[model samples]
Target: MTTFTIGDVTITKITELEATGDTELMLPDATPQAVRQVTWLHPHYATEDGLLKTSIHAFAVVTPTRRIIVDTGLGNHKMGRPVPAWNGMTGTFLQDLTDAGFPPDGIDTVLCTHLHVDHAGWDTRLVHGQWVPTFPNARHVFARTEFEHAEAAPGHGTAELFADSVTPLVQAGLVDLVPANEQVTPEIQMVPTPGHTPGHVSILIESRGERALITGDFIHHPVQLARPSWTSAGDHDPGRAATTRRVVLEELARTRTLLIGTHFPGPTAGYVIPDGDDTYRLQSLA
Candidate 1:
């Protein structure tokens, strides 16, 4: 139930799952030897044995005029997923969100950074053998390029994801395809940080002179802050992803904006501090 206040805007973490080790599946280059080199990662982002820690969670963002849920995590009873553990997940994600004061019906917007399996799984739920939109009253938002790419050639397990989670929303007329840089609200704007996906976007929240950035997949682990060149194995364009990471880290570090990592472990919010000429580290806000 971690929460952060950026002026009048409030962002709450609604955790669905957390795990350690098995990072190589997402980051092929994040070997034990390589992860151990970043000393600051110990105890939170990584273990002493060099296993990376990560979480699957959604953020409940509350502004003066809107209640938004950013990135619904892997859903329950999802079949044919590449990862066995991710399939048929029975976690209390919706209950957790409700307990945190953001119920599905109460959410006015469902903002997906990208339409990946893990990020958009909970967009729909299985109801009487049919997939249906979970947030019945909220508008499911997606980047136009992302929606088109996933529709045409959904990669790996994404074909099933689109059919069960994404397509249902579109069929229900609850989807809103917008540009990558669409302004969600006056205080919440989408920051185009592509490469992880063709239309990947990070969220930017600014209000009353305070600011924060919710990093989607462009920067997976805190280790990327130290080694900006290390890209996720799932990245659509590794080189471009690395470039986006490096550029974003520099700007965030310079402005000292609070960085909220979408997959970052507990104590996920932080300040991107410049560690070296071209390297940075997250100074945990927790």
Candidate 2:
């Protein structure tokens, strides 16, 4: 279990699963030769052969006032995943959460960065042939634009995701639709960082004087931090994703804020250090 704290709030990384994906697939513009040039990526983010290492994990943010879960990872017993491996996945995610000291009923809020298949899977669980909210007592919060955009959005990619993981929460009156920049709590706020999805946002956590940003797929891998232009395969809008990535990086590098990538591989939290005029490297906090 990896954990970090900013002032009074404590954030822990509870991993649901870890796996390696094709580097070229993760960054379409990245060639094997190109990736090797970025020496900083090896040993953690990528393999010697350029396979991109990644993890599906959730951040449990425990504030003095609220126990919030940011981005539930790909859940168990889910189906209709475009990728066969993610479909019908079974893991000890809840047990892992409990092991980390946050119980299901103890979670006060579920913050979804976006409704992508992997990010929002644990919002609900299947029981007795029915879908139900996993966190019986927590309020599942989603960006209003993101919640509405899923309805008219093309493709059935997120259709099963909505029916199984999201709609059930709404049916249970556990879903709250807020603006993209909604202030979740006194120390936690959502930053409108679109491009991965229309209403995609990152969690900006501040308390006392310390700050950290939970990047929800706005930037998937650390490689993008260096190139700042190599887009993810799952990006809804690669061009806009790249643009937003650069802007986000500037702020992260400028202030050296702690960055936690939702899908980043080993040691997910880090600081963006300026390596050159246009290059930034992830200096892991581990």
For candidate 1, the per-residue lDDT at 190 reads 90
Off by over 4 Å in 1: none
- For model 2, residues 1-286, the per-residue Cα lDDT tens digits are 7899899999999998888755555578777677778888998988897667888899999998999999998788998987677889878999989988999989999999998888889888889989888899999999999888876684545988987888788788888899999999999999988887889999999999888999998888888878888887877788899889989999999986899899997889899999887679999987
Q: What C-alpha lDDT do the candidate models reach, one value each?
A: 0.91, 0.87
Inter-residue clash pairs, candidate 2 = none
lDDT of 2: 0.87
lDDT of 1 by residue, 1-286 (tens): 7999999999999999899998877898899999999999998899998999999999999999999999999999998888789999989999999998988999999999988888998898888999888999999888899889888877768899988998788888999989899999999999899899988999999999989999999999999999999888899999999999989999998887999999999899899998997899999976
Among these predictions, the greatest lDDT belongs to 1
Report the Cα RMSD per candidate: 0.8, 1.2
**Any runs in candidate 2 off by more than 4 Å, and if so which?**
154-156
Clashes of 2: 0
